[model samples]
Target: MSTSLDTTRLLAALENVAVISTTDLQGNITYANDLFCKLTGYAREELIGQPHSIVRHPAVPKAVYKDMWDTIKAGDIWTGIIPNVGKGGGVYVVDTTVQPLRDAAGNIDSYISIRRVINDLMQNFEAVEFSKETFDEYYAN
Candidate 1:
């Protein structure tokens, strides 16, 4: 296949299957894929120009956010299992990877996050109500 065709196919596939969002350097949403919007139960309009934290779940600790910011701000990739709250307050889990997108001048312009739904991988079926206590107990080993 030609390079253009390959690029087209890759984008189509990513659009269909990947939960994707891009945030500006300050963390305002710049773009959101359909899958992301559907998963978060928010429209693209509601997401754009808003902070990416609009979907942040209470169960996530501040330390995690600090770590993620530190990693991505340094032009490194950050990967984690993130639990997000939807428009109606339902919670969902995703295996997420975040990386910086650089401009032509080699300066980091924005961050792109790609995620996969991991609901089936969760042991507890009641993850919608997942809280800090539940998270601690689940990981207590």
Candidate 2:
């Protein structure tokens, strides 16, 4: 049992900080929350009907997306750390979860993605990778 007040507060908190978007089965953007639009630098009107791949970053391995799609298409939720490109080519990292929405007839209707920016974590990871690469290069030479 949940009170309306509790639900409203939770919704408000998520809306204020979370990047949320929904896409059709074909991967066209159907809905994007205010936070998502602000982060992506796209107006709601511009995003609608556009492929969700618009924000995909080249640095992210293709296998990552393939796994995500395979899992969600199988009606399972997919969670991963994704590097995305924002407007103006700014790179951002997000901890993302995508879930398939099913219709009443048991068909997949769409996908809903919830993402939280993880800039600090991503920076640390990048630094670690760079250090590893530099050390390997020096020792190999």
- Per-model TM against the reference: 0.83, 0.80
Name the lDDT of candidate 1. Answer: 0.92
Runs off by more than 4 Å, candidate 2: 1-6, 123-141
* CA lDDT of every candidate: 0.92, 0.91
Question: What tens-digit string does per-residue lDDT give for candidate 1 at 1-141?
Answer: 544667778899989988999999999999999999998889999999999999999879999999999999999999999899999998988999999999999999999999998887686656645676687888995
Check candidate 1 and list the clashing pairs. none
lDDT of 2 by residue, 50-117 (tens): 99999999878889989999999999999998889887788888999999999999999999999999
lDDT over C-alpha atoms for residue 136 of model 1:
86
Clashes of 1: 0
What lDDT score is found at residue 5 in candidate 2? 65
Worst 10 residues of 2 by lDDT: 1-10
- Count clashing residue pairs in model 2: 0
